[model samples]
Target: MPAESNMSTHSDPQSSETAFLEMRDVVAGYGNTTVLHDINIGVENGQIACLIGPNGSGKSTLMKSIYGFADVKSGTITVNENDITGRSPQENLMAGMSYVLQDASVFPQMTVHENMLMGGYVFDDDSQAARRAEELYDEFPILGDIRNQNAGTLSGGQRRLLELARALMVDPEIMMLDEPSIGLEPRFIEDVFDRIKQLNNLGTTILLVEQNAQKGLSVADRGFVLASGEIKFTGTGTELLNNDEIGRLYLGG
Candidate 1:
């Protein structure tokens, strides 16, 4: 692994104690296959942290491991100082974490409003889900305008927005997004990123895995570089963006 850049902005040795989400010495992967080794990362509360790397660097695996989709061979994962290792996806959702996958995940046959309500299925009262959907629609008026339309009929950008809105129905404390900008036109990418910032500003911490390195780091409060299943660099967004080595090796400078 490359040496971490020396220009990090937050250098406190006790940062882990303050981190809202943390992974310590995690070794994880699919069954019978270990893809991550000794992974340690932390995302501060209410901050946007971006993970970037070349293809096949185990970015998606890390996210899956955190959300309990992948097996963790060893180590601990935590949120708000609560150990959450090996928690189920449903449990994680109930614990205030939401994950938006890299693939298109909308229920094609369902109407936009119905899909949004699905996100709040954990709610015991159906009326609560309905009210939450209305709150989301207010935040995303574009989704509200097409509330009755089938989700499959929406454009790429609109679909992405709906996915985001759906995830917000539960008002999660932290959201994990995998390649949120994928499969969209250049015009929609910026819009999606802007919404991400908006969500962060609204007090949701974010862990983002983005293929677009430069753009991802540009918006991140903190950045991590994962390569060959290990972390190679850790720094503030600006620190990584300006480092000559990172610029050459990862940012296509």
Candidate 2:
């Protein structure tokens, strides 16, 4: 059984020259080799901000660094004007932010509902955790229908959805998703994308790392193009799509 989380406070944000998340002059990577260099990004409140680039472009590395999974050599990561760089994973998780890593993210042996419980494990009250799980199930009915099924046995898309349900267990105001469409069949891809928007519509700011460029931009309110760990371009998703150079260079024009 998992404990209940305190999700009473949602992160209030400012959009005027203010970003809920900002990474400035960031240079980080594995032990000694740096993958991201002088990276800067800003995500405002209630938006789907996406990062897209070729493989090895440090997209995932940047995401991990923001979540405190990668090593940071220089820079700052802030959420809502508060400094949060180098915060431990649990620290970030408890600060109204949650992560749903690519596919293969859930506890394979746990029941669907059990996995939801695990997501809110940090909460101190068991009753609170239980209530949160019930709420998540209602938000995601697929999981509700298969609450007792082993998570490992669900289809690729179903598992991805379940991971999202778990992330909501803590009622996070921010979600960082990494390549969620991986291993999913084409038909359910749209559903996954739609759900991502639904999360944002409900007030969960999203920082997304997606491989499918066109699809990613379609849902993104803002987009960043990363090259060799540096931001090459930043604009509204529509602006990027309409740019002659950006379309030819990145969007399969």
Candidate 3:
């Protein structure tokens, strides 16, 4: 892994002692569609927990609920022990949470700096946001060097890195990443996962939804396998990885 970045704790270690975040029985979907059923998930203050499964397993749907993009019909979503279910994205940001979707989360026409500034939208002062952006850039030097460059021009891997950096502007405690490694080449996939593992090491509780099951589980401290909007298995990465049935079923043997 690259040098570890500063940890992003879900709660200020000096100020609180609570689980960073929690999603209890989250059921969400399109209008009357109800794709996610009784989904329960959590991310500890400084750990990486991943969800992996075949496509159409409500992975993205659950992510949307956590980020307040989709309506969570029945369940509680909390951050630092405060209820956040059904809150808007803006509200979630104010609560010190960040979300990075699989697509279009980055402003194509904006410079990397501009994109990071938007991450700190809750802040009213440009200088403070800029300083936070600079701190993020420092965490990802490859992104820092191109901070002023148009985000649309970056390579796929670079753009993903930019999104991760931008999500850190609030110095978020739990950074929910939806498909963090989507659409990247094999080499870059390793690079991205390495960075994610590094983020976990830095104490950022990451709740990741990934299509690449094998790779996602390899780096996770814990893993869940979702099927048809419900959790079918939950275990440490190694436990799931060693399960012969899981290896053959999801990891493609």
Candidate 4:
């Protein structure tokens, strides 16, 4: 394993004590290859926390580990004070967590309404799913206008919007977003960031893995820097952005 970055934690101790989501001393990875080392991070209720680092810094792997897609070698992951390490994705969803994957994840052949319905498939009743779909339509008018159109016909930004809308069908309390702004035009990228802010305002605790470090930190309540599969820094977003060494090393200052 590589040496961990020498950085101090700047998290508010009180906030961490009451954090709704937390990973403590985690070591995780894919089959037989450890990628994360003694990692720790936390997000208070309804706060937007961003993970920013160089490529292969275990950012996505942390999210994957939380969602049970990666193998956890040790440590614990918790939500609302409940242990959820190694829970299946479906179990996590039922526990009020939702994960929005990278790239376009909609069913391209399905109509907008169909794709939305699929998001609520976990509901036991089809009628409940339909009601949730209607609620999402009201929340996203563009989706309503194109409810019958094929998902593949939409532009990149629109498809991204659709993915976000579908993810909301469950009204998850905690949302994990992986590269929400990837492949988007400048205008669309700004729009997506605005949407993410809107979602956070509506009380969804957000854990974001973004390539746009500056923009991501701008919207984040807390920021974490991962290097060599370990946390190099943890602090309020502004602290990291303004810190001389952190800014020069990670934010391309």
| Runs of candidate 3 exceeding 4 Å displacement | 1-19
lDDT of 1 by residue, 132-243 (tens): 9998888888899999999999999999999988999889999999999999999999999999999998889999999998889999998988988998878888878877
Task: Show the lowest summed lDDT stretch of 10 residues, model 1.
Answer: 5-14
Q: Name the better of 2 and 3 by TM-score.
A: 2
| Model 1, CA-based lDDT | 0.89
Backbone atom clashes (below 3 Å) for every candidate: 0, 2, 1, 0
Model 4 deviation from the true structure expressed as Cα RMSD, one decimal place:
3.7
Indicate which candidate wins on TM-score. 1
Clash pairs detected, candidate 2: 4-125, 4-129
Give the clashing pairs for model 4. Answer: none
What is candidate 2's lDDT per residue for 1-253, written digit by digit as tens? 1111311011212222578788887889989989998887778988899888888999999998988899989988889888888888999999888988875878889899888889989999888899998887778887889999998899888988998888988888789999978778999899999999989988999989888888888899878888777787777676666666677777788
lDDT of 4 by residue, 160-246 (tens): 888888888889999999999999998899989988998888889999999889999999988898888998888777767777777
Ordered from best to worst TM-score, the candidate numbers read 1, 4, 2, 3
Estimate TM-scores for all models: 0.95, 0.92, 0.88, 0.94
Task: Flag regions of model 2 displaced more than 4 Å.
Answer: 1-16
State in Å the error of residue 170, model 2.
1.1
**Model 1 CA deviation exceeding 4 Å by range:** 1-15
